[model samples]
Target: MPDGTELIVTRSPPVNSNGVITLTNRHLPQLKWQESLLIARPVNQFRDFFPEVNNQNLTEIAIEIKETYNDYLKSARSLEDLKNRHPELREPYIEVTSAKSQRTIYLTRLDRFGTLESVFFSQDKQFPVDLQLVNNKIDREIPNSLLAVATLDLEGKSVEQPIGAIALSSVEEYNLKAGINM
Candidate 1:
C-alpha cells in the first residue's frame, strides 16, 4: 500500500489488455494495480547506499578538505597557481571574485557541461559531490538530502568508500534486466 500497509494477495487475478491487474482482495477492494503503487522485490539483497553523514569522522574530513584548499588558496596568486601547486585538484573548476567586496569563491564543477545543477553522486564517477568554498564557509551538494559517503586521500583526492553492492530501484532493475540502458 502507498501508506506502508501490506496486504497479501489471496488469489491470482487476470490482467487485461492494458496490463492492469484487478485486485479481488477484500483489503483493497476494486483497487487496480497501478504502476505507481507497485513495489517489486529487489533482484538481490538490498544494500542501503545512503548513510548518515553526521558522523564525526566524515565531519572532520570535510573540515580538513576545506582547510587544505583554503591554505593553498591563501598563498596562490591565482587559480592557475593553486592548480599548479596542488596537482590533485582536478579540472572544470569555477572561480569567481566580487569586485565590490573582494570576496572570492571557488567551486569544483561536478555536472555535465552547461548543466545548472550537480549530478547525483551515484551517477557521477568523478567527484562524489560538488564542493564549494566561499571565504571560511564550505558547502557540499546533497541531492534530495542524501549524502554519498566518501573520504579524502593523502594527496587530497576524493576517495569514495566501498559500498558493497549498488542497489537499483525497481524500475531501474527491470530496465537493466531487459537490456535497457537507462
Candidate 2:
C-alpha cells in the first residue's frame, strides 16, 4: 500500500543460546553476529536470559496502530466542527486533536446529564461547521453500543495525530440526578 511513500517490513530469526533463546533479532545478519558473539563469550552465558519472542505479533501490532490512527482522524474532524458551531463555549470544552493526510482534527465531548450520551468531532474550518465523513469500515469496527461523529478538512496541511477523548452523557430533565463536576 505504498502509493508514493516507501514501506519496509523485515523480520529477524530466533537465536538459540544453549537450550534457551535469549533474544531474537529482526535482521538476519545482526542476529547471526550476536549469536556468534554470545557463543564466543561462554558456553551457556545467555541461557539464563531465555525469553520467547513473539515474532507473529508484529503484523498484528501494525494493523492495530493503523486502525487507531484511522479512528483518531475521524474523531478529530468531528470535534473541530462542533467547536466551530459553539465558538463561545470552545474554551470550556476539552479538545483532542488528530491529523489525517493533510488536515488536523479535534475531538471533544460535552456532558449534558448524568448518563453518558453522544460524542462530537470538528471539521477543519473557521465559519460554518462541517460534520466528519463516515467511513463504512470505521462504522463496522466500532461496537454497537457506541455512536461516532467526525469531520474532515481536506484543505488543511498539518500531519500531527490528535491526542484526546470524549465521554458523553444523555440529558434527562425528568430524572432528578445531579452531575458530579470534576
Return the top candidate by TM-score: 2
Candidate 2 residue-wise lDDT, 79-151, digit = tens: 7776555443363343322233323332232332111332222333443333232222323432222222333
Candidate 2 local lDDT, residue 21: 34
lDDT of 1 by residue, 46-142 (tens): 3365345668997788679768876775665475676664442454443334344443333333342223242333343433222221121122331
The numbered model that scores best in lDDT is 1
Could you tell me which 10 consecutive residues in candidate 2 have the lowest summed lDDT? 173-182
How well does candidate 2 score on lDDT at residue 64?
91
Cα shift from native, residue 54, model 2 (Å): 12
lDDT of each: 0.37, 0.36
